[model samples]
Target: MSFILTLANLLSIAAAASGWLKLSDGPWSAREGLMAVEDASGIVMVGGRANLGLAAQHDVWRTPNGSSWERLPDAPFAGRAYHAMLSHGACIFVMGGQTVALLGDPFFNDVWRSCDGGETWDSLGHAPWQPRAGLAVATHNGRMVVAGGCFGSSIGAGRKFLNDVWATRDGASWELLTANASWSARSGPRLVDFNGRLLLLAGEVGFTADTQLGDIWESGDGATWTLLTATPAFSARSGHGVVNAGGSLLLIAGWHDAKCLHDQWLSEDGVVWRMVSNATWACTADACGRFDFWPVATSSGLLLTLGGSNAYSTFGKLWAETWALPLLGGGRPLRGGSVAMH
Candidate 1:
C-alpha cells in the first residue's frame, strides 16, 4: 500500500508540473469568431468574420473538446458581428448585432433560438429594444437579461451609447427592467452571473476618444443596480470576457487604449481584483488578441477563449484560433482522488 501510494503521488506531481497553461490553436478558424456557452452537450461557436474583407458570417459550429470542431448548418439570419449569444433552458438564443456594409452598418434587434443544438434555428422576431450591437446579454435570476450597448449606424456617426436594462423569460417577449440604470451608458460591458447575482464589468462609454470604462455594477433583480466600484483594479477596457471559475470570477483579455490586451484578472467578490497572468498570450491583429473574444467555461472546467478580432476598429483581422486555460486551482486532484488532465 505504501508503494502504491508513493507511485500515485509521484504521478500527480508529474501531471501538475507538466500542466502549465498554454495556448494552442483550435481546429476552426474565423476572421471574427464568438463562442456560445457550454450547453448540456458542448460549447458552440457562432457568427464571425469569414474573410479579410468586411464580411459578417452567420455560420455556427460546435465542439466537445476545443481541438475538434464540427460546423453546423448555416443559420437562417444574415451574417453579423459583435452579437450576443446565450444558452437558456432547452434552447440557445442569439440577439442584437450589426452587419458590415459599405454604406453604413445595419444593426439588428432580431432574436433567434435553436432547440436542436446548432443544427437548426428559428427566428424569435425583433426584440422590443431598438437595433443595436455590442450589448451585454446573459441569464440572470431565472430570466434572460440584455443591457448596455451602442445604437448607431457607424462609429461616430449618429452613435448613441445605452445603459438600458431589459429582461425576458421567453425569448420572444421582453420586459423593460429599467429604462436607465445607475451605470453610465457603455458598450461591450461584461454581463455575467456571479454569486447568484448579475454583475457588469468594464466597457467602452462613448464613440469618442478616451472613453473606456473599468467600473463594476451588481444587481439581485434586473431593475435595481448598485455600483460596486467606480474604479476597478484593471484599466478601462472593452470587449473583455468574464466567466465564473469555481467560486471566483475571472476576467480575460479585452480592448484598451487602441490596443488589444492579453492580461487576465481574478476576483472573489467582484469589487476586489488581482491580476493573475500577464501576457500569457498577446492577441494581435495577426495572432488575435482578446478583443471581442467570447470566453466560455467548458464542461471540463477550462477557460476557452473563442474567436475575436485582433483589430480594435477595423474588420478582416478576425481569429479562427482558440485558446484555453484551466480554471483557478483546477489542475490539482481533489483531496486523495486522482484527476485526469484536460
Candidate 2:
C-alpha cells in the first residue's frame, strides 16, 4: 500500500513539471542579424548594417534580461549583409554574407567564430555553403544544418533558389544531407528545432514574375523531410523570423511579396500550426527584421527581443518587446492577438 502511494506521488510530480514547462516562456526578441547567437549563457547578437549596401561594419548586442538590453563587442568581419550565425557551447559560428567588391558584385562564404561571448570574432575558415543570400541555418546536436537559399549570376533574374540541405561542424567541410526535389526550392526560409526535431518553415522562390511559399516541414534527421503542414500560416512569406519562445515555438513577422508581415504562430510538435494571441503585432519595413530575432533566456525566467530594423523606416526602430504571458499550469492554448506596430 505504501509503494502504491509513493508511485502516485511521483506521477503527480512529473505531471506538474511538464505543465510548468508548457506555459512558461523561453527567451525571445528581435535583433540585428550579426548580433544573434544561441548558447548556454543566453542569446548574443553581433554586427549588422543599417542599409542594403554592404560596407564593412562592426556593432553588437546581447540579452539576459527580457525587459532590458546591453551592448557587446563589435564583430571583426568586414561588413556584409544576409549572413548566418549559430551558437555551439561557448562559441558562436557565423557564415555566408554579402561583401561589396569593386564592381558592387557582393557575396562571400567566409566563416568566423566568437569565444568571449559576442565581444570579439575570429575568422574560422571558408564555408562550403557556396556564395548565397537570404540563406538560413540552425544548429542541432553537434552539427549546423543549412538549407534553401538564393545565389546566382544576377541579383534578381536567373537567381538559383535552392532546396538542398547541408550540415557542418568544422566550417572547412560540409555534408550534403539531402538534395532531392522533395523540398520546396526556396530562399529566406526559417530553420529551427521543434519538439526535439528539426524543422524548416516558410520561404520564397522564383523571380521575374516572382513566387513565394509559407509551407511547413519537419525532419527527424536533416536529410529526409516530411510534409507536415501544406498551407501557409498567414501569407506566403520570406525574410521573417522564428525562434523558441517559452517552451512553445513562435513564428514572428517577415516579408511577403515585398510587404512586411507581423502575424505569429505557435507549435509544440512543429508540424501542426496554430496562430497564437497577438501573433501579428507591427506593420513596418526595414533591414533589421530580415533575419532571426535574438531571444535570450534570463535568470528571472523571461524571454526578450531587443532593437532591430524595419523595412519601411530609414532611421530604424529599436524595441524591448516581450511576450510576457502569465505562467499558467499545463498548456492553455492562447490563440490570436491584435496585429499592430509600436
Candidate 3:
C-alpha cells in the first residue's frame, strides 16, 4: 500500500481506540482463505487470499510466539480463502474453503493433510461432496466431522447447502455419517468439539437472507446426531469465531443481523448459554473469512484475535494485529491461531 494508506490506518486505529492501539503482531499481510492451528510448539497460519484478481496463496507461516512469523512451505493446492482447517494430533487437516473471491465463490471441497507442521502439505483425497466452502470441520475420537456450507456461488441461483453430515479417519479415506437431517443447509456455521460431542451453531439457509436462529446440534459418534441446544442465546449469524474452552463453549465475533457482532456468549453444557464479553473487546470485528478474522485461544488463557487489515478500510491494511479478549479465570487455553488469510 502507499505510505498515505499506512498513515490513514494509524489514524483509523487512533479513531477506533480511544488513543492508543493495543495491537499484537504476527506474520502480517493482507490475505484470506487462510486458517490457523495452534499447539504447544507454536502457531501455524496456513494459506489464504492474496488479491481480488489473483488466486489464493497456499504459503504457510509459523510463529513460535504470537509476535513474529517465519515463512514456511506453501500448500500444494491452489491458494484459497474461507477454507475450513483444524489441527489434530500431529497433522493439520484442511478441508473445504472458497476460492479467490471468498466464501462460496470458488468453493473447494478437496481434502489435504499437513503433518510436518504446515511446512508441507499433501493431498489426502477428494471429498464426497463437490468443491465447496464455508463448511465446518471438527475432530473427535480421531475422526474429522464436517457439516453445513453451500455448494454453489450464489445462495439460490444454482448452489445448494449441506444438511448432510460426514466424517473421515484419514484424509484419503471417507465415510457417510448422515444423508440428510434437520440442520440448515447453510454456509459459515460454527462447529466445535466440546467434551466428547460435536456442537454446531448458527448459519443461513436457502435463497433467503435468513439471520440468526437459536439452535445447537450435537453429534457423538458422527453417524447419529441430536439437537442438543433447543434454545439458543444469540440469533443465528455466519462467519463467527467459535471455540471450546475449559469444558465450556465460547462464541464470539461474527456477522450477525447482517452486521458484524461485538457480543460474546458462552455455553457450559454446549446448550445452556450466557453472555460474557462484558469487560473486554469493545469493537465489532469483521467476519472470519478475511484476514484477522479468526481468533486463537492461548495456553495462557487469553483469547487472541488474529490479524487482517486496518479496521477502517481494506486498502493497504496490516495483517499483524492480535487483539486480546479477556476471559474469566479457571479455563485453560484451547487452541492457538496458526493459519493465515488475506
Highest-lDDT candidate: 1
Per-residue lDDT tens digits of candidate 3, residues 1-342? 455644335424543443223355544565533578786457888766555325566778877645557888667887777677888778887878766555434777788887888877788777887577777788888888888777665644677777777877787677878778667566767778888888888766642436455578887776667887656867666556777766667776554444545556676787776665422244434432222367666665556666543222334433545555433352422221221111
lDDT of 1 by residue, 1-342 (tens): 245644234434533543223333545556553547778768877886556626787888888766667888889998887788999998898998888776654788999998888889998999989788889988987799999888765445467888999999888988999999999988889898888999999988764348889899999987899999998898888878888767778787777877777766778899987776555343224244557777777657566677676675665466666655655464221211122323
Off by over 4 Å in 3: 1-26, 50-55, 101-105, 206-209, 278-280, 284-292, 308-320, 326-342
Model 1, TM vs. native:
0.86
Model 2: worst 10 consecutive residues (lDDT sum): 18-27
| Distance from true location, Cα of 293 in model 2, Å | 5.4
RMSD of 3: 8.1
Best by TM-score: 1
Query: By TM-score, highest first, what's the ranking?
Result: 1, 3, 2
Give the backbone clash total of model 2.
28
Q: Give the TM-score of candidate 3.
A: 0.78
lDDT of 3 at 139: 84
> In model 2, where do residues sit more than 4 Å from their true spots?
1-35, 40-42, 51-56, 66-73, 100-105, 153-156, 206-210, 278-301, 306-336, 339-342
* Runs with alpha carbons beyond 4 Å of true place in candidate 1: 1-27, 103-105, 155-157, 207-209, 282-288, 329-342
The C-alpha RMSD in Å for every predicted model, in order, reads 5.7, 9.1, 8.1
